[model samples]
Target: MSDTGLHPGLVRPRPQRRRARSRTYSATVRTLGPLALLVLWWAASATGLLTPDVLASPAEVLRAIGELWGNGQLPDALTTSLTRSALGLLIGLAAGLVLGITTGFTRLGDELLDSSIQTLRTIPFLSLVPLFMVWFGINETAKILLIAVATTFPMYVSTSSGVRSTDPELIEAMRSFGMGRLALVREVVLPGALPSLLAGLRLSMTLSVIALIAAEEINATAGIGYLMSQAQSYARTDILAVCILVYGLLGLTADVVVRLLERLLMPWRTPQGATR
Candidate 1:
C-alpha cells in the first residue's frame, strides 16, 4: 500500500526502466531528422525534381563508393589524407602547447608574444596559399604547413583561455603549501584547464580535416581532394558526391573521437539519466 492507493511494488517505475525509455526516445528523435532528410532526397531524385547532373542520387553515390573501394582508390586516398592530417595535427598541437603555456603563465611572455599571435590569427588562412606555394613550391612541406597553421590558433586560444581561467584562490592555497612553480602548474593549473584543453584539441582536429581539403588542392596527385579535382574535370557527379560524403564522415569521426576522449578523461561529467 502506498500513497494514491498504489501497491508498493508499483509505486514508481524503476530508475533503470525510466532511464532506458529516455535514452530510447532520445535516440529515436535524433535519428528521425536525418532519416526524413534521406527519404526526401530519395523521393526528389526519383521524381526527377533533382537531376543527377545537379546532384547525384544517394544510390549513385553509394555505387560510386563501392567502385572506388573495389578499385583500391578509396582506401589509398583515405590513408594518405589521414596520415597528412595526423602529422599536421601533431606538429600544431606541440607548437600550440608551448605558446599557450608560455603566454598563459607569464606576463612577460604574454606582453611579447600574445599580441603578435592575436594579429596573426586575424589573417585568413586561404590568403597564405600563394606565399606558401612560393616558399615551399607546392610540395608536401607546403601542404603540411598549411594544415598545421590552420589547426594551431584554435588550440592556442583555447589553451590560453583555459589556463588563465584556473582559480586564483586555489593557486594561492597551493603556493602557501610550498608548491614550486612547476609542481603548481603540473597539478593545479593543468588539471583545472583540462576541459578547455580537450575542447581545443577537438577544435584543432576539426580544423585539421578542413585544412586537409585545401592543402590537397595544391597540385595534389592523390587523396580525396585530388579525386574531387579529377571528378570535376570528368563531370562525374557521383564521384563528387562520394568525396563530399567522405569529408562529412571524417568530420563526424573526429567529433566522435573527441566525445569519447571527454567521456574517458572527464569521468565527473556524467550524462543526464546515467547511472553515475
Candidate 2:
C-alpha cells in the first residue's frame, strides 16, 4: 500500500536486516586482517623464511613469556615500570590540568603562559634526556620526570582546546544567574572540556608507556627496558619480542581504561547499539 508498491512493514524489516548484516560483515573484516597477518607470520616462521635471530616465532615468544613469568622476572619488571608510569602520569595530569585551566579560562594567564608552554612542547622530550640526567641524575627521579614531561603536553593541548570550545552564550547565561568564578568553572567549563580531557588522558597514558621505554634505558637495573637490554646483550630475540609485546599490551590496557572512563563519565554519549 506504500509508494512504489512496497509494503511499509516489509521495507522497514529489510533495512534492519541489511544493517545487521553490514555490522556483522564489518566486525568480521576487522578481525580478519589481524588473523591473516598472524597466519602469514606463522607460515613464514615454519618455512625458515623468518629466522629466530631476525624475529622470534610466535610460539617461541609464547615460551619466552612463560619462562619470564615462571622465573618472576616479568612480574617484578611490570610492577616497577607500572609504578614509575603511574607516578609520572599523576604528576603530569595535575600539572597539565592546572596549566590548561589557567590559560584557557583567563586572558592574562593565556598571555603569560601559553606561548612558553607551546614552545616547550614542540621540542622532542627524548632530546632532554641528557639534561634530565645531569639535573636529576640517572635515578628514579630522572626517569619519572621524563615520562611526566612526555605526558604533559597532550593534556595541556586537549584541555585548552576543550575549554575554549565551550559555548560563550551558556557561560553568559550562567553569569547572569549569579554564578561565581569557581562555580562557573566547576559546572560549565570543566564539563564542557571533559571529552577533550579524557582524550588527552588516553594520549598521555600511551606516551607514558613510550617514555617509560626510553627512561628505563638510562642505566636502569630492573624494568622491562633493563630486560630488553640484557636480552640484546645475549642475543635473545625471543625475550626481546616478549618485551615488545608487553609494551604493546600495556598501551592497549591504558586505552581500554580510558574507554571505560569515557563510558562511566559520559553515559549520554554511548552508542545506541552498544546500549542494546
In terms of lDDT, the best-performing candidate is: 2
Scored against the true structure, residue 240 in model 1 reaches a CA lDDT of 97
- Tens-place lDDT per residue, model 2, 1-276, is 887687767754343332333556656876898789889989999999999989999999899999999999999999999999999999999889889988999999999999999999999999999999999999999999999999999999999999889899999999999999899999999999999999999999999999999999889999999999999999999999999989988998999899889989998794445422
111-143 per-residue lDDT for model 1 (tens digits):
999999999999988889889999999888899
Please list the Cα RMSD from the true structure of every candidate, rounded to 1 decimal place.
Answer: 5.4, 4.4
Error of 2 at 161 (Å): 0.7
Q: Against the true structure, what is each candidate's TM-score?
A: 0.88, 0.88
Model 2 bad stretches (over 4 Å): 1-30, 270-276
Superposition TM-score, candidate 2 onto the true structure: 0.88
Local distance difference test values of all predictions, in order: 0.90, 0.92
Stretches of candidate 1 above 4 Å error? 1-24, 271-276
Whole-model lDDT for model 1 versus the true structure? 0.90
